[model samples]
Target: MRKAMPAALVTALAVHLLAGCAENRTAGAGTDTTGAEIPEKVSAGTVIAVGSPETKVALQLSGQIDELPFKVKWVQMSGGPQCSEAFRAGELDVCSAAEVPSIHARWTGLPTKLVAAEFRKDPHRNPIYELGIAPGADIDTLEDLRGKKIAYSPGQAQGALVLRILARAGLTEKDVELVELPSTGDVYPTALGSRQVDAAPLGGVNIKRFTTKYGKEGGKTIKHGLRDDPAHLWVPTESVNDPQKAAAIREFVKFWARAQVWIDEHPKEWVEGYYVKDQGLSREDGEYLVRINGTSDIPADWDPVVERHQKTVDLLAEKTGNEPFDAETLFDRRYETVAADAVADGRKGS
Candidate 1:
C-alpha cells in the first residue's frame, strides 16, 4: 500500500508547478555552473529562476530547497476589461492590451507603465475597423445606418476605431443602435449575415474574408473601409514610465521584437501562430495581416512611441472630449533601455 503525499507537500508541489508554468526558467545537474536548490514558494512580480528544465535536475542535489526568490504569476484575459480587473486588484505588474484600455487604465491610476510597443494596425493591410451592412440590404452609407442595429466589441481598440470611423462619417452611437458583442469576430456572422442586424463593424481580417466571399458570390459591395487614413495603430497598454518597470517592459518588448525576425525567418511558425493559432485568423489572411499591421521592432525607447502615442491620445480626446493623459509621463525609460539593448545586440525582430 502507498500513502499519498502530505497535504502541505502537495500544496508545495502545486506552487512550484504553477510557478514553472511561467515561461522563463533554469539549468541542470552535475558539472553545472550554478547548483542552486529548488525554490519552495512563489509570488507576484518576482522572476522564477527555477523553471528551467536544466535547473530542476541540478537543484535536486542542493540543500537550499525551501525558498522562492521571486513571485511568479500568469495573466489570462479576453480583453481590456479582464486586464483592468487584474490591474485594479493589484494582481498584475505588467500587461499588454490595445491602446484604448491603456487610456482608461492610466486615467484610473492603475500604475501601469508603457515600456514598449508591439504591432500597429495598418489601414491598407490591416483594416480591421469597418462598417459592414448585410448583402443586398438597402443600407448604403453612414446616413442609411440611422436607427439601424450595429454590433461592436466595446472597450477595445477595435471598438474605439469603429466609433471614430463612424464619427468621421458624421455618425455617432446616438445615430445607430449599438450591440455590445465579444469582438468583431464573435458577432460578425450574425451582425452581417443574420437578418437580425442591418450593419456591423468588423475588423480588417473579417472584412477581407467577407468581402472576398461576397465578391465571389456576386454580392453588392458595400463601402468597405473608412479608417484608412491612419495606416497603423499601436498597442502599449499599462506601461510603466519609470526605470524599473521600464526594464521589465523592455524584456517583454524584446520578446516580441525578436519574434518579429523569428517570424520572418520562420514565416510558417511565429507569424502564423500569433495571428492564426492565437487570433484564429486563416493562414493566407494572416500572412496578409502581417504585411499590413507592420510589426513593432523597436524596443521601449520613448521617442518614437511617444510621438505615436501622442497622436492616438489626441485622436481619442477629440472624439471623447477626454484628452488623453499626457503620454510622456506614462512611460518608463528603464524598460525602454532593455528593448534598445536587445535590438542593438543584433536581436532586432520584424
Candidate 2:
C-alpha cells in the first residue's frame, strides 16, 4: 500500500480541492465570476471594513462593537448604489441594503454574495415605503397610477418596489410615464412637490415630511400593500475569499443578527442612538421611524426567502430586459443559518 500523506499535506489538498470546486460553480448565466470559500475561524489582525452606518450605530449603542472578535474599520456610507461603488473599488468588504443591490450588482457583472437577511415582523403593517402622490395629482388608488408620471430608478429598491406595485395593480410600465430619476435624499418628495413626477415611493421620515410640507397643496401618501422589507448584509466575493476576512465576516454576521434583536428589544435606545443622535433626527421623527419599521424577523429557513428573491429577480428582469439568472446564486447558503442561530443562542443566554 502507498504511504499515507501527512496530516498537513492532506488538509492543504482538501482546501485546494474545495476552492477548485467553488471555482467551477456558476456565478450566474451571463456572469464570469464565482464565489469564494468560507474560512473556519477568524485569524489575528483580521479586519472587516463595513459601510452600514445603522449597524455601526446599533453596535456602538449596544456595546456590541467592543465584543467583536476582529477589528472593523467603519466606513461612512449607506445605500446599495454607494456600497456597490465601494465594492467595485475594493475599498469595502461588507454593506447593508435591500434586495435590489445584489440583483443589480449581478446584472452589472459584480461578484457579490448576501450573507445575512432580515425582514419586518409584520411587513404589511410596517412597510419600508409608501407611494407618495404629488400635489393635485388626483391619484387615489393603485389603479390611478395609469397615465401618471412615475419616478423610477432601475438600480434601487424603490425602482423594484415600483415594478412590484404595478404588477399588484395589474399594470405595466407601458401604462405609466416612467421618468427615470435618482431616488436619494429629498429627491422623491422634492419631485412630488414640484410636480416633476406624479408618484414615487417615499420611506422613513420622508413619508410624514412630504405631507407636512405639501399637505396644504393636496400632496398625500398611500400604502403600496406589498412586501418591500428585504434587509441584507452583503459582501464582495473577494473579501470572502480571503481566509482571515471570511472568518471575521462570519463573526460579524453573528453580531449583526444579534443587533437586530437588541434593536427590537431596546427600541427606545435604538431610536435615540441610531435615529436621533446618529442620524440627527428629532426625537419625534425617530420614534415615527421606529414605529413604522416595527420589529425585526430573522428566519432560520431561507428557502422561502430565496423563493421570494426569485420573484424579485424575475420582476426586475421583466422590466430591465436583463438576462434572468438563478437568484439562489446571489445568496451564499453557507450563511443561511448563521444569523438565525446567533439570534437563538442570544435568546438562550438571556
Candidate 3:
C-alpha cells in the first residue's frame, strides 16, 4: 500500500523547497512574509499531493517546485470510487475526479473539497468515448432503444452518469434493457462492433474514426443524446484544509495552472513527450490523439470553467435522486485567493 508522507520527510521537503523561495524572495524580491522585509526563512512545511496523470505532470514541470513550502507528491488511481476509498482511508491529500464522484465521495462521508476544474471541450477531447450501436443495429436514440439491452456501470460514478443522459432523453432504466458491463473498455468495443449490447457512450475519437471501419459511419452519435460539458476537478477536502494542507493545495493549483498553460502552448511537445513516449502511444496515433483531445486547457483558477462542473453535478444528482452537496463547501472558492497569489508570484519573477 502507498504510505502517507512522514512528518520528518515532509519537514525536509518543505525546508529544501521553501528555503529556495525564501532566498528568492530575499535577494529576488526583497520582501518579508507581509513585505515587511523580515528576511527570515519560512520556518517549516510538508509534502502536498494530488492525483496522477495531470497533477503529476504539472508538479514535475513546476519551476522551483521543490522550492515550494512542501514536497509535492502525486498518486495514480483507477477511478472516482477508488480515489474516494483512498481518501477515506487517509491515504490521499488532493484528488481529481468527475463531478459525480465528488458528490458520491462526499455522500459517503469522505470530507473532501473541490478546488479547481479540469475543463474538457468537445472537438478536442481525448479518448473520444461514445454510445455506439452494433453494426447496422436499429438503435439510434435513447428513446428508440427502449427494451434493447444496454450496459450500466457498477457505481454511479462513470457509468451511472450515462443514465442521466437516458433520463434527459425521455427514457429511464426501466424503459430500456439494462446490463452491467465490466468496464468502459469492454463496453465501448462491444457496442461498436459486437452483438453483446446495443449501445454505450464512449470517448468520441474512437467512435469518430473506428465507426467507419465497421461501416457504421455518419450514424447517430453519443452526443445526440448527451450534451457536451465540463467534467473533472482537483479537490482537497475539509480533512486536509488545515494550514499545511492549504499551503499544499495552493502550490498544487499554482503549479497545475502553469502546467495547463504549458500544455496549451506546447500541445505538440506534450503529445510526443508525455503521451507518446511515456504512455507508449504510437507517433502517428499520438499525433491524432493530440490533434483531437489535446485541447482541454484552461486558466489555473476556478472560473466559469469550474462552475459548469458544479451545475453538472447538481443536474446528475437531481436526475439520480441523489443529494447535491453544498457547492460553496465542497468546491471552496477560497482557492481563488491562492491562485491570485500565484499569479502575483509569477509577475514578480518575470
Candidate 4:
C-alpha cells in the first residue's frame, strides 16, 4: 500500500486475485473450477430426479406437478426397453413401465423395485393389449395363431402378452413362426395391414385406427379379458436406499395417484390434451381410445398385485424356459402405505 508498484506487476496481480476469487466462489457453489456442476448433495437435501416414458402427459399435464417440493429432472423415453437400459446405466433413478418390462429388469439381475402399480379400474375389459389378425387372414382365436407368421418383439410387453396368450391356447414359440418387428406402435398395424405378419398385438390408439381401417370383419382382435395388466413405477436399488430419493419417490407416487384421479374426473381434457394434441390423433380416434381403455387406479394392497405379477412371471418362465423367481421379492412394500394414503386423499378430492 505504501510503495508504488510497476503497472504490469499490479495488473497481473489483480488478475490472479480475481481468478482465485472466482474459483473459490465456484467451488463453494458445488461446482469445479472448470465450471462442471457437482453431483447432488443428498445429505444436504437437494433436487430429485425422475424419468418417464410419456413426458408431456405424465409430468406436465394439467399443472399436476406445479407444486412439487423437490426439483425434478425429467427424461423422456419411447418405451420400457429404453427406460430399463437407462436405469442400468445409472442415468435414471426412476421409470414408469408395464409389468412385463419391470419383471424382465428384475430377471436380468438389475437391482430395481416396483414401488407402485396402476391397473384399469374396469379390470374385466382392460383393453391394454389386443391380438389383431390381418385383413382376410384365417386366424381367429389364440389357437388359430399356429404356424402363422406373427409379428413379435422379444423382451417387450407385447411379446410377453403374446406368450401368455399362446400359453393359454396350449401353444409355444415353436407352434408359430414369429417375424421379429420393431416395438414401435405403428409397426404392428403396418405389419398386419401389409400382410407381412398374420397377427400382432395392438394397443391404445393404434387399436382404434386398425379396427377402423380394416373393420372387425376385415381384421379381428382376440379379446382374452386380461385383468391383471398393471403398469408400474420402478426405482433403482440405490434410490430405494437413499432417504432423500425414497422420500421424493413416495411423494411422487402420491402425486401420480392424484393425477390418475384427475384423469378420471377430466376424461375429455385428457383425451384431447394427451391423445389429440400430444399424440396427434384425430379427435374421434382419441375419444374412442379413451372410451375403450377407460380409467386406471392404483392398488392399495400388494396381494392382488403380486398374484397378478406371479401369473405373468410364471407364463414368461414357462414359455422362455427360464427359472421363475419370486415376484413378491421384486417389489418394495415401503411405498404401499404412502400409496394407500394418496389413493384415499385422491378419492376424497375426486
User: Which residue runs does candidate 4 get wrong by more than 4 Å?
Assistant: 1-45, 53-59
Window of ten residues with lowest summed lDDT in model 4: 29-38
Give the alpha-carbon lDDT of every model.
0.48, 0.84, 0.55, 0.70
Per residue, candidate 2 scores C-alpha lDDT tens digits across 1-350 of 12223323442453454443234332322342335457777776787899888788888888988989889999998778789778776789999888998987776667788889999988899999999999999999999999888988877899889888898899998888878777999999999999988999999999999999999999999998998999899888777666687788889999999888999899899878888888899999989988888999998899999999999988777676667889988887878899999999999999
Candidate 3 residue 122 Cα shift, in angstroms, is 6.5
Clashes of each: 29, 0, 19, 0
**Backbone clashes in model 2, listed as residue pairs:** none
Q: Output the better candidate (1/4) by lDDT.
A: 4
Winner of 1 and 3 under TM-score: 3
lDDT of 1 by residue, 241-344 (tens): 22233333334444434434444445555445456666566788878765655544444445766676676677655554553668776554544565446556
Candidate 1 accuracy as TM-score: 0.61
> Model 1 lDDT vs. the true structure?
0.48
Candidate 1: worst-modelled 10 consecutive residues by lDDT: 25-34
**C-alpha TM-score for every candidate:** 0.61, 0.89, 0.72, 0.82
User: Cα miss at 5, model 2 (Å)?
Assistant: 62
Of candidate 3, the 10-residue stretch with the lowest lDDT total is: 30-39
lDDT of 4 by residue, 1-350 (tens): 12223323432453454454334432432411212222333333445557763533854676866766677777767356787667656667778787887666555545567888888877667668788889988977778888887776666788777777777788877788767676685899888888888889888778777888888558877786555367888876666666677777777777777777777777798777888888888889878877877787777788988888898888776665556888887788777666668869767765
User: What's the C-alpha lDDT at position 44 in model 3?
Assistant: 53
Model 3 lDDT tens row, 131-164: 6676656876666777776655533444555666
